[model samples]
Target: MDFNKIKEMGLEYAEKGKNAALDLAEKGRTQAKIVNAQSKLYKAQRQLGALVYSLAKGNEENQPLVDKYIEMIANIEQEISDLKASLEPDTVIETTFEDTEEAADGTADAAAEPAEEKPEDDEAKTCPQCGAPVSDDALFCNKCGAQL
Candidate 1:
């Protein structure tokens, strides 16, 4: 009830708020780093695949260049792993090239599939580009981002 006690309580809450904000900011930065590293990892893997493919087709091989790409990709993977570990368990975002490729393939397959009959209510809608379910009021396809 005392004025001094209320002021001390207010200061404690303010300090807690500041700490929470700092923790959240740090998590955001870590998440961004993880995303950047993932992007680099994907590019390096793609390049390595291309190099191997070209070399195979030409009946040749460059072990040094291939090794370099492998090393770069490994380093990026380690960095991403470390960044993910730094994040809280619930906040971690894990991804793999296989998953991404599968998702891309799924999108392509969806787009190739034919659309089904519309519902009688007119509330149900599907994306013309991808055949994904969409809200009737949506202006763009949520799955394929095609304009509706």
Candidate 2:
């Protein structure tokens, strides 16, 4: 009965369907099939809007209408979930850019600070040059030949 939520869910389904259709096109599927799928998705969204309006009118005998709307909403959610599951793994790497003034200030602060002594527990077992794990008794890294 929450019209806004219903509308939002409807829009979400439409977007997911659009994306799925586009994915099909990218994989060389027929244009007619994609367009047909898009048309069905749009119709479903419109039906959802109509259902919401009908349910909001305070008709006591509209329970079946409400139930149908709920079922449609669930179907849309499932479609979106399926589409998301079919997508390939994507990695997002984010890089931050600092203002020139901030960078210069940070650099100056770093230069003024004295290096801290390493903790006793933090022994140089790993290769400092390549960071490969090494034995505690090793005098030089076997992988990079760098002295500990």
State the TM-score for model 1. 0.57
lDDT by residue for model 1 over 65-131, one digit each (tens)?
5777777678677766666666645543443333333333433433332243335665567888999
Best by TM-score: 1
The sequence of per-residue lDDT tens digits that candidate 2 reaches over residues 30-144 is 2332333344345446655564565476552455544554564465444433333333334121211122223334334323422322344566557789999865433344455
Best-fitting candidate, scored by lDDT: 1
Task: In model 1, state the lDDT of residue 137.
Answer: 39
Task: List the lowest-lDDT window of 10 residues for candidate 1.
Answer: 105-114
In candidate 1 the C-alpha lDDT for residue 33 amounts to: 60
The lDDT of each candidate is 0.63, 0.47
Q: Which residue runs of candidate 1 sit more than 4 Å off their true CA positions?
A: 89-148
Against the true structure, candidate 2 reaches a TM-score of 0.30
Q: How many steric clashes between backbone atoms does each model show?
A: 0, 0
